[model samples]
Target chain A: MEFEIEKIAQLSRLSLKPEELKKLRKDIESILGYIKTLGDLKTGDIEPTSHVLDLENVFRKDDVTRINIRDEVISRAPCVEGPFFKVPKVVDKE
Target chain B: MEKQLYELTLKEAIDVAKAEGPWEIIRAVIDRTALLNPRLNAFVRFEPEHFLKKSRKSEDFKGVLSGAPLSVKDNICIHGCETTCASKILRGHVPPYDATVIRKLGDAGAFFLGQCNMDEFAFGSSCETSAYGAVKNPWDIERVPGGSSGGSAVAVAADMTIAALGSDTGGSIRQPAALCGVVGLKPTYGRVSRYGLIAFGSSFDQIGPITKTVEDSAILMNLISGFDPHDSTSVNQTVPDYTKALARNVKGLRIGLPKEYFVEGIDPEVETKVREAANVLKQLGAQIKTISLPHTAYAVAVYYIVAVAEASSNLGRFDGVQYGLRAPGKNLLEMYFETRNQGFGEEAKRRILLGNFVLSAGYYEAYYRKGQKVRTLIRKDFEEAFKEVDLILTPTSPTPAFKINEKISDPLAMYLSDIFTIPANLVGIPAMSLPCGFTEKGLPIGVQLMAKPFDEEGIFRAAFALEQEIRIYKRKPKL
Candidate 1:
């Protein structure tokens, strides 16, 4: 029925101040308590629904065509100037 | 002529607006919106000038919807227009390109009336979670129209627009349609292109129509059904003329009433409406038979695990570094945390957390994998049932629309709103909600029709027939 800011922030990959965490704990619990109904069902023989109807292996050819938007795509990339894909440092080697 | 468009199907109303100028009709919608939207909260934004100009020259212009007013749920991207998805995170974020559906609708001559409100990021069942504000029902201003497509449904119900398009994942389209007393069809998974729709659950997400009648919905669906290479998941199939298939003849076709669907917990009124719809099918010469979909009970549970798991991964892209608004902070990690912490609403954060836990290294097998396996069993249940019948029947939700504040405080209550409708999304089949009946309090009840994958024709034929037989088709929302 209750949650801690530290635990939820870790689960959600978010960071918050002590006060913010205190607020988040109540909010997360309020939301989690609401989502918890799925746990009460006797899902035993019942199959869970992943896709409404079944769609299996819809295939497409592996043929490669022109990188159609070569110019437009490269031109629009945010912080890029030349023919390279530039991205902010996302991960650091531990 | 200005009385109400809610009383007419989109086709008839469009024809009338075409023969006559759309000025009168559009004005009437605007007027009603003024009187009604104060309580309904159906629209997130409006551009009366653009809509009027298009309607005046409707005949001179060309497209299937020619000046037929339509609202887009906040998520569907429109070039130079906001696609907020009722979330503050995307507040003021406008897409540079039109979602494929937006382009199609625009090309087809449909008037884009502006965005409709919804649950934040399309994450909640009731419209209450929206950052803008919760949308109240047209039928009863205090009650919700159901969501995440609540505003779209409310617009159609309140006559703010003739028809609207909404995205459905786990009954977002159909549940709201049921609550608002309209028709909503979530086509087979790949039936409509998902090119520019904001994702919640990519595998289950689909754009569907919310309209006054089955035939009108068919016309709209036909225009949007063809494959778009832009969306890798869009199916390339021959787009059938759905309207032509509605000949009021579904005689001798097998109709399956899954016992699991009719079990306890469904409100008595909802059960009555669904049962009465079954009787109508029988009278029309279809053989009604009871069938067992043993896995029905697990639908909501499995849906949450898999949907949240996908949601967590899908939502990961919303980090501060990528796009949209961000809170300035020292260091990259602070930037990411601050942006997301301030950006996402309560429900979205909860899902991301739950998704993280379920999809984490240790618990992935028990929650995500097991949910998938159970999903397969549910699919098999539908498969076995389909062999014995052409269609399955059930109530769209456990009850008619609940009050706005009633379930918004409890996320579990909101998820349960999807219990009756999620099974079809899980199996990837076409399902629709047809206005079946109303409760004593005058709220709408929706009867659902589900058919096998790629067999949308059966669904259309059934809903079209039911629309004709259901006496409530002529009734308009009291708003």
Candidate 2:
């Protein structure tokens, strides 16, 4: 199958130069060529192991113990207004 | 004072700090780091003043790692310090809170030396991919230090720090440790908490120790391994005093030699030394048997798909919205594209792209699903093997440190470096790399020992026994 480099980069929120994409295409092809070997393995009836641990549904008591690092966190924003992280507007004005 | 402190192990340093003082020792490490970091590039960022202030109160503290300096991998957050993950994305960013491990280490009185360099977002096997520039191996400056924990390993190897913390998501810790000729342990997947570590592949990621000796790895393991309410994956199992597991008797211990690890691509010297190490274990009364982990060949392929799939999701948070580098853009989507494009290194982009492709529509079943199913087969290989043997031993890396740029262009070759170490991460087992021998060229080689889940004691016992039988730990690379 042909790998769609541009589409994948767009989906991944990355913008690569044409030259860089050309090089990456070759590398990705090589990597996927190797990865395709997994298809040859007989994995029938094998349960997909997403996580190794058996622990599940971990719960913690609801409490007002959260640390107030809001100011500290907002301070790291590239652009901030008061305690808010400023970002470009998502909606277009009609 | 520097020479004396450099010679002492983590255990010995604590004793000396208690008897004498920690000021001189702390200053010596800082001085050594200052002296060597220029050449080794082992650190991404260091705060000498902050370290000096902390060391002043070191004498009054009473913890097992008291006053011993530890260089942390750049990915682990340390409050008020740069946690760049050796990438441009986190440029000018300082974490507001410490990782759970950092807090634990501080509570234990371990002094923070600085932030060590690593593969950008822990993406590469060699440190070459780091935005901070490649960290040179202390053994041979011309060769690349195995990474993404390369800086941490180099720091310990060069005596720039007593020990360092490195996260392993597919051999980041063990590979570098082996290449640097230090003892590195990747504890059981859930053994160490992952609360503060910058996530690479959350399922496989673990924070482990890179130290000068096997006992030092145990010492650091005791301090870090435990259940954290903050991390859901962290097991509630009783954390054992790992130091007690350092008993040298491996008698009656069944060790398995996986035939697949000693394949054609493995360096002859590494194979010879590891075989000698297995023999040494046999002479020490442990039973050695040839074993087959048939699915081992599929590990690297499976790991890349699974790791990148998870990484793509994990790294999606770095979209220039909350913190980290933000490129100017007319809209939010453009901003994310620009920021990531300018922020991430080449390898990080490649992995993110590939990860997204695997999880993309029409391809998920063929790639991601198949990868996870084969991941089960890989895990089952260990499960079946562990039922018959107490531990599995193999060469930590196929070869010693390769010359810088030797395999940088070929990502596949770089991925192959982790062939022996990746399986343990896949299975969630505890594994370690300790010095076994060196090549005739003086480059260090290490043998890997893996144990069943939460059986850190088993791996520690076997490693300690082999460590005692082999005196290779005494040899230091002359910087």
Error of 2 at B63 (Å): 1.7
Instruction: State the TM-score, rounded to 2 decimals, of chain A in model 1.
Output: 0.63
Q: How well does each candidate superpose onto the true structure, as a TM-score?
A: 0.88, 0.98
How far out, in Å, is residue A10 in model 1?
2.9
RMSD in Å for all candidates: 4.2, 1.4
User: Model 2: per-residue lDDT, tens digit, A12-84?
Assistant: 9988999889999999999999999998998888899899985578999887786798988888788999988
TM-score between model 2 and native: 0.98
> Which whole-number lDDT from 0 to 100 does residue B158 have in model 2?
88
Put down candidate 2 lDDT per residue, B127-217, tens digits, no spaces: 9999989999999999988988999999989888888999999999999999999999999988899998999999899999999888998
Compose the digit string of candidate 1's lDDT tens values, residues B51-87.
4554446553366765677888998987667677887
Model 2, position B129: C-alpha lDDT score: 92
